[model samples]
Each structure stands twice: as C-alpha cells, then as structure tokens.
Target: MSSRDDTDDLRRPFRHTGSWYKMGSRQSSVMDSSVQSLREGSVSVLFCVLIVALGPIQFGFTFSIFGSLSNVGAMVGALTSGQLSEFMGRKGSLMIAAIPNILGWLAISFANDSSFLFMGRLLEGFGVGIISYVVPVYIAEIAPQNMRGGLGSVNQLSITIGIMLVYLLGLFVNWETLAVLGALPCIILIPGLFFIPESPRWLAKMGMTEEFETSLQVLRGFDMDIVVEANEIKRSVASTSKRVTVRLADLKRKRYWFPLMVGIGLLMLQQLSGINGVLFYSSIIFQSAGISSSNVATFGLGAIQVIATGIATWLVDRSGRRLLLIISSSSMTVSLILVAVAFYLKGNVPEDSHLYSDLGIISVVGLVTMVIGFSLGLGPIPWVIMSEILPINIKGLAGSVATLANWLCSFLITMTANLLLTWSSGGTFTVYAVVSAFTVAFAAIWVPETKGRTLEEIQSSFR
Candidate 1:
C-alpha cells in the first residue's frame, strides 16, 4: 500500500488534528501498528482508569459516624476496585458491589442504634466506591467512540440527579424511607446485569476469543460488522499481554508519568475545590447565609447541578474536553470569588439592613454558579480524560494512586468543611476560590483535548 493509504488508516478512527502522525513507510507502519495495538489495550485498561478516575461523593458531615466513615469505606473500596474487576470480570465485580449497597441501605433502613447506622453507611460507601469506578469504565468500554463523551458525561449527570433526588425527597420522606429508597436502585441493577454483555476487551484479554466476539456483536448490534473492531480489540489484548510487568520505577519515564500526573492532579484538585463541601453542607451554608428555606435551597442547588450536568453531557463531544474544562474552571474561580466576597460582606453588614439580604442573594447566585461550573467540566471530564490518556501498562497501579488521592482529598474537604465554615465562611470559600483559579491554569496548560481522538492518538501525544 502507498504511504498515503497507511497514513489514512492510522488517522481513520480519529479524524481530528493532534500531536502524532504516521508516515507511509513499512517501518513506520510496523511501529505504528505496535502503538495502535497498545492503544487498543484501552479496552482492558479503560475500566482500570475509570476506577481510579471517578472518585465521587460519599457525602461527609459531622452529624454522625455516617460522614467520615463513608469516605473511609470509599477509600478502601477504591483501593480494591481494580483488582476486584480484574479477578471477577466487570459484571461479577458490579454484582459484588451491589450486595454491599443493598445490605447497607437495608441496615440503615432498619437501624436501632448508631452501630448499625455506621455499619450500613460504611457498607453503602464501600459499594459506591466500587460502583463509581466500574460503572463509568463499563460505559466507556461499551459506548461507540463517536458517542463516548456524551455517554461518559452521563455518569456525572446521574450522580447529580441522584443528589437532587435525595435533596428533593428529604422534604417528604423519613430518613428510614430514604435509606430503603437508596437500596432499590442496586436491587434493580442486580437482575439487570443478566441482560447486558461483558466488556469485549476484557473477554479478549482473558483469551475468551469467541465470547469476546459475541459480546462485541451484541454491544454493536447483531446486524453490524464487528470484524474490524474485533481485530482491533484482539491486537490490543495481544500487545498488552506481551508488555513487561509495570513497576513503580517505570513512572520515572515521561510517557509513563505524564498521563498519570494529569489524571491524579485533575481528580485531586477536583475534590480540593470543595464541591463536596458545598454539596454535603449546603443546607447549613444556606441557613447561615440567611436563606429562609435551607432545605429548599439545597434541593434547588441539586436541581441546578443536574441541569448544568445535562447541558455538559450535550456539549462535551461538541465543545471538546480542554475547552469545557477551561470554561468550567474559570467560571468556578469567579463564582467562588463572588461567594467569598459575599460572605465577607455578611460579617460587616447588619442583619436587618438591605445590604445583608443583597449579600445573601449574591451568595446564593455565586454558589449556584459554582456548582454549574463544576458539573459542566470539572465533575465529568476528569474521568473521561483519565480513561483516554493513561498508558495501558501502568493503568492499574496508576489508577489506584489517582483514586486514593481523590478520595483522600474528598475526605479531608468534607470532614473539615463544617469547621472551616465556623472558623470563617469567607476564608473557606476564599481557599476554594484560589484552588479553583489554579485549576483554570492547570486545565489550560496541562489537560489535553481528548474530544474526537482515539485512545492511541491521545497516548501518542504524551510521547
């Protein structure tokens, strides 16, 4: 084949411009093929990164052991998620995760004392920790490349929706009823697993060739020709199988470390920006800000997050990852600053004065805007980028490190938010605002635009 033909083949899957290119020479084709195969390892490594990349809200508070214990459980679960998925397969791991969630919720529902409540909360967090990683990875593997971003964003959108549901339902339901409600989703998921196919790449990696092909066929639709995609997955699995065992020393290399750094940095910074603090303690924050209906305001905040995240889902593929991140981070910085200023003014103004109520209004608007900013890019894009960028050989270890970092940051932020608010609300938001400002710079300088790029193309850019 002509050089042009070979080049076209390399570029076919990713039509957008990026850092890597291929020459038509046979030598280059061979090298490219090797890299392509490695990139294809994305199928197996996808869940690995997702596990590390998607540390989400195990909402923390001081109200009970529930707050800190859940995050502790999630940290533990995140640590184990990669191995569990590897040993049990994606479907098996999810089933394992669901059991804890169901039992935790039930335990919470019927709790007679703090011990049961704590146990249930911890179990619930453990289940969420595993599910957070596995579900996104599952979605990333199964989704068509063209639809990946939109579908990936759905993961965050669902989290926002769940938060909203909880806030909205808290008004009408007793805590016991809400706990029972929490169990229902997992209960429903248990049986639904039977209907879905396992990750084809995983099957391929495990040397279950026929099963891999069948799963791919089912996922892509029975009528579709999966021959090309199937071969790609097989090559990926084959190349990955031959790679040397990854070690801590391997991280010294730029190609190995850069993507991991990006993944960990984005996730850690995401939590440090105090999104969870705002979420877990929004009721108290609103009340202190002089809102008449703190519960209603909290619910509204959740609703806004859902709406913003939905918009993000629609825009992720269209606008690209880097752009959304920059926009999102910038908006968050400004919104946080606005909040800090409002809170500062609240201290200086008299409660009965017009300025105090105006400051409250400003605080509300700023808080809402910050949540919107987060849901748009900071919330979902980190997972998508991590799934796309991490090198396959180091995926598991790197993923675990990243997941641990995220959950750790989440624990620290959520655990301390109430104290910080009491210490000085203005000071708390000021810290978050500064972190958010740094995130804007980080997104602009470090985060790559993964939109419309194949995993191989993305990884190659790091080289």
Candidate 2:
C-alpha cells in the first residue's frame, strides 16, 4: 500500500525544468510536451464537468429548476383540471390529457439538451394534474354505492403501485428508456378511452340525457334497474344547476363551505404531515437510523406502503372512510412521536454505544409504522372524500381548488423538509406528529363517512 507521501508524489503534475537539466535533449523535449498535454487534458475534463453539472441547459439555477419544473406544471394543470374535465367529458378529458403525457415522455426520451427535458417534465406534470382530478371523480360517480369506497381507494392504490414500479424499473434502465416506458401507459390509455363509459354524472350534468342513461346502463349492466340511480343523479344536478352560478362568495354558504373546507383541509393536512419529505429523504433517514443498506430499506419502505395501501383498498368500503381516517391519523401520530423520541435520544447517546444502535432501530421501526398508518388512510381517503362530497355544480371549480391546495402544500413541504431536518431531526418529526394528531380530530369531528352512500346522498349530507 502507498503511504501519503507516495500518493502525493504520484499525483504531482509533471514539470520539465529541474528534471530536464539532467536528461537527454530528446527525453527532455518529450517530457515537456507530455506535461503540457496533461495540463490541457485536465482543463478540458473540468470544462466538460462544468457543462454536465449545470445540466443540459447550462444556465444558472437551471439544474435545480429542471427537477422542480414538473411540480410547477402540475400546479398549473391542477388549477385548470376541473375546468378541463367539465368542458370535456371525463373520458374526453382523459384522452386529451394523455396527448401531452405521451409527447412529454417522447420529448424527454429524445432530449439531447435541457429544453426538451424541461418541456417534457412540464407537459407530463400538466397531464398528471388533470388526470388526478378526473380519475377519482369518474370512479366515484361510476361506482356502485356499496363498492364506492373500495373503488375510490383504488385510485390511491394504483398510484402507490405506479411509484413502486418506477422505483424498480429505475434500478436497471437508463433515464431515456424509463421516459419512453413512462409514456406507454398514456399511449395505451388514448385508445382504451374510446371503449370505456364516460362518467354518467358528468353526462347528466351536461344534459345529455340519453348518453347519461346509456353510460349508466353500461356501467351497471343492462340487466340491472338503473331508474333509481338515474333519477337521483338528475335531481342532484338539476337542483344545483338552478342556483346562481357559484362565485367565491357562494362558498360562504354552509352547504358549499363545510364540505369544501373538509376536502381542502384534509388534502392540505395530508401534505403537511410531511409524507413527501419523509419519502423523498428516506435514504438519508435510513442511513441516520443505522441501516447499512439504505437503498434496500428505501425499496422496502415503498413495498410496505404499496401493501398497506392495498389493504386499505380492501378495507375502505367495509370499514368506512371516517373510521379508517381516524385510525390512520391516530396511528401516524403515535408513530411519529416514537420517531421524534428516538431521534432525540440518539443525539444524546455516544455513537459507538449499544443505546445508539437501539435508538436507531427505534427510529426505523417508527418510520415504518408511520408509513403504514399513512398508507391506510391519509394517503387515499382524502381524494375519495373530495370526490364524494363536492356538489356537481361546483365540482370542477371547487375540486380544482382542493387539488391545488394539495399540490401547493406538497411543494412547500418538499422545499422546506431538508432545511427542517438539518435544524433538528427530532424537531422535524415532532412537527409532523403534531400535524397528524390534529388530523385525527379533524377527521373525527368534521369528515363524513361516504361509504355505502350514493353520490347524491353523500352530497346531500353536506347540504
């Protein structure tokens, strides 16, 4: 093995003057030329690294912006998502949404420079923003009252599954290949949209009576009696439509305000609980928890979330929304408190001591428990509740507001989490625990159970 002196000697750049005085003329010339070549080579390498480090755009802060552009796009898309869905039918909106997603992925895949990559991310974000709102509303409107909770829960389950799939694929594939794959689902969706039934409620609201009935019949089966459900949808839509067009002031009404508050509050709190920050920095968290294989632990966390969300899907309809939310939030509070205490204790213990290792394990356990608790309720139910409770008249505009609040909170949390963690891991977890504890009370007192209730029935409860 080389000592520090030897390593330093090896690294020292070649120089001509001193050695050349004793060397043959030809050897001296050759040495001097080689040294010049090495100097130029080093400079060239640094220039290339600078270019790469600045990202394909090579502008100041562009690299950071590149990573966050998608979120910005998503926020814009969310702002308009309700309007787009209302303008076009659910199926139509989804088809339109898929176009940008496909194009975005293609742009990303073929990008030689940063502009295409940035544009692609923006487009993808926009498409996702629209889909996020429409998909859940469509599911809630189409599903049978008995099965609505389970089906609505699937929206979140599918999200967790997609996230897990991306993580797994990312392990082996290049980013370009992954981008191409990212577009595939959207591409397939374009054609599939043609065959699926449009949301019956949407059709009803549009006054496409024949199409609404047809769509409902298709979803419920021609053999099933559709009269009861059809009438209920018409009555709900008709009554809401007759009121003056909802303005910001109209939301002050209890019917409008209560459900909207609950929906937006839950969605915002979901983000405030710092789920994204935790997941985003899971690797760092695991390392701090004394896990040797942080990557595996991260993947394990994703898998656990997927499994827990799946269980939530199965339990949602049977157990009811409010109960699950209460349980989920309460469990999350406890888990986060455990994590906070562990982090606090770890700081006081010597790193080499047994107590340090035990504290680390406690942190790991607390984090896992928190993830499970989140997956069971906070992750999925808020969207379900949002879709269920909002009136059809204001759903597009109001739902957009709710969705926007969620994305905004998500951005804030993602941006600040690192700073908070840097300040104090224990303190960061303590803040999250407090938020989760508040969510428990919010869900219990304010959030309604929409399980086993028709859309009209659920909306009526808000009135």
Candidate 3:
C-alpha cells in the first residue's frame, strides 16, 4: 500500500480531534452510538415514564372518591384528551393535566364539606383520564422498539405502587395528609418536563423538522447517528401527514377498524372482568368471607399486586405481550371460579361450623390468586397493546375512543358491583369468571405479538 493509503487505514480505525479519540470506522461508530443511545434513551424514557406513570398513581389514589361521579369526570377528560394532545402536544398536555391534579389534591386536603371533596375528585379524575391515554401514547412514541414494552409496563407498575402506597398510608395517617401526599408526584412532574424532550414523533408529525431531529437526537444521545431512525420517523409522519386531519369516516378501512376494535375490546374486557369492583370493595369481600382482619388482607392484596406488576415489567419484552395475556386471563378465570365456589360453599355452611371456617380460608386464597393472575398479565398488557397497535394517523382519535370505552365499562362495573354483591357474591364472581374466560379466547384469537417490532412494523402487520 502507498504511504497515504496506510495512514488512511489507521485513521479509519480512530479519528483524533484535539485530545479526544473518536471511532472512525462505520462499524465502531454504530456500536458506540447504540450504547450511547441506549443510555440516553434510558434516561429520557425514565423521566417520561415517571411523569406519565404518575397518572396511574393518581388514578389509584382517587379510588377513594364516591360512586360513578369520578368516572363522569374521567369520561369527559377521555373524550377531550385526544384534542388536547393534538393541540398542545404530548408534553404540554401532561403539564396541563398535572395542574388539575395538584389543585384537586390541595382542595381535598383542606376540605370540611362534601362539596370540596367531590369537586377535588372531579378535577383529579379529569387529570388522570387525560393521563391514561397520553402517557402510554407518548411512551410508545418515544421509546426504542426493543425497550418499548418494558417501559410501557412501567405505567401499570407505577399504578400498583401508588395503590399500595395509599393503602399503607391510610393505615397510619389522616385522609388530609394522604391527599397532600397524592399531589407530590405531579408537583415533581411539572418541572421535570422542562428537562425531557418532546415526543420526536409528535414534533415530526407537526412539521417541525429541525425540532424533530433535535428531539430525536437528544433522546438517542448527542453523539449517536440518528439519521436512519430520524428518516424512519419522518417517513412514518409523512405518510400520514397527507391526510392532515383524521375523521371518524376514515375508520371504515379494515386497517384502522381492526386495530381500533382490538384496542377497545381489550379495554372493555379489562373492566368487565370486575377488577375495579374487586379492588373498590375488597374490605367488604373479606369481611363477608369472615376474615378477622380485612384491613391486613387488603394490604396484602396491594402488596401482591405491586410485586406481580414489577415482575411483569421484567417479563413483558422477553416473553412478549400475547402469551402473558393468555396466561393471565386463563389463571384469572380459574381463580375467580375458585372464589365463586368458596362463596357458594360459605353460604351453604352454618356460621358456627368448621365448614364455614374452611370456606373462608378458601375464599381468601381464591381472592389472592385472582389478584396475582390479574397483575401477572391483564392489568398491564392491554395498555401496552393499545399503545402499540394504533396507527399514528388515527392515534389521537382512536386512543380517545378506546379510553372512553375503558372508563365507560369501569363506570358500569363500579356502579353495579355492590348491588351485584348484595344480590349474590357467588353470582358476581361467577360473572367475572366468565368474563375472564372470554378474555382468554379474545387474546388468543386476535391479539398480535408486538415484541421486537417497530411502530411502523406493527402498523404494517394489520394491513
């Protein structure tokens, strides 16, 4: 080789700028970029995850609110979250959501009358309703495909953690103190948004090309080569941007209609399985089952849920989404059946009899198993799938529709749970059991495997 050719080969391995040594070869650069991108993506996703995750915590915390009233407020928010997200972008919408949450918690903390409590709950519900749709959508938009499912699972994990925190705190502190504590997450989240980049996909979709590349770079790492990924996002955005506006009529196409149906179906089954009802009146269920310490049992239930959801975060990407849902739904079906059987047996046995005591123990076991089954799969996976399956063109409107369906079902279940229990505990559980069984069939038949797929790839699968 010539002298200059030899020097060029050496330079190809390493480039020196001042005191810094940078990789010169494409292979080395790509490797380094991937590592740095992973790190940057982790940090960026962590903040986004923390901020949006708070919405679920808020959702769980506000479970103390009375009746279907909070659901009414949440329904209103769900319907409007799409417009808010479209107008202000994802980060801005979340910031706006945080304001109401903070204000709502503050109102609850100082409340002497029912009006303040009710109003506070309404505000809190509205905020979480927006969060329920936006956070998952934002996370899906920003996350690298490999990390998306795991990060998306964090939303549900945060919710389980929030529920446990409130339940634990309720054991020690006054309601006012708990309300103050509830506001703290949003207080932290509002300023944290300034540190994180806006969703690059959102920026690209809005035609802010320079900002889109910049945000994507920030997310992928300053030193990383984001050109390939950037182009992919731009292409995805460009394909949808031609339409400019998404209307309900566009949903008539099979590609749009199928995914929308999947999103709405999973959410509908999620509520119809009676999770909220079980959670809302867990104490009553335990008491009726003859548990001496219903509070302790409730606390245990929260602990189990948190632990199971945490395990799910680790498993989601590795195991994929559909398998977990099937397992979760099937197990929940069995557990609910066990609960129903226990309830039926308890009703038949005399209170003073040994059989009654045995039935009580069986009921507790069944309830705990039901919770474990739920946390294992159904609780987190549907949201992950919903966020994954929707095309960017219709994400805002379809997300709103799916979320509205979720809250609507939640309202119906919550409203009827107590009455159903009054009529027959065995019957209520049997109904939930049947619904859980149907979930298994639904997941097996329709839900797609989304692991290791890009957003564009996922959308393409439907077509």
The best candidate by TM-score is: 3
Q: Regarding TM-score, does 1 or 3 come out ahead?
A: 3
What lDDT is reached at residue 209 by model 3?
Answer: 64
Model 3 residue runs over 4 Å out of place are 1-34, 63-67, 244-247
How many residue pairs collide in each prediction?
Answer: 1, 0, 0
Residues 322-389, model 1: lDDT tens digits: 99999999999999999999999999999999999999999989999999999999998887776677
The better-scoring model by TM-score among 1 and 2 is 1
- Cα lDDT tens digits for candidate 3, 378-426: 9998989999998887788889999999999999999999999999999
Task: Sort the candidates on TM-score, descending order.
Answer: 3, 1, 2
| C-alpha lDDT of residue 288 in model 2 | 89
Runs with alpha carbons beyond 4 Å of true place in candidate 2: 1-67
Clashes of 3: 0
Give the Cα lDDT of each candidate: 0.76, 0.77, 0.84
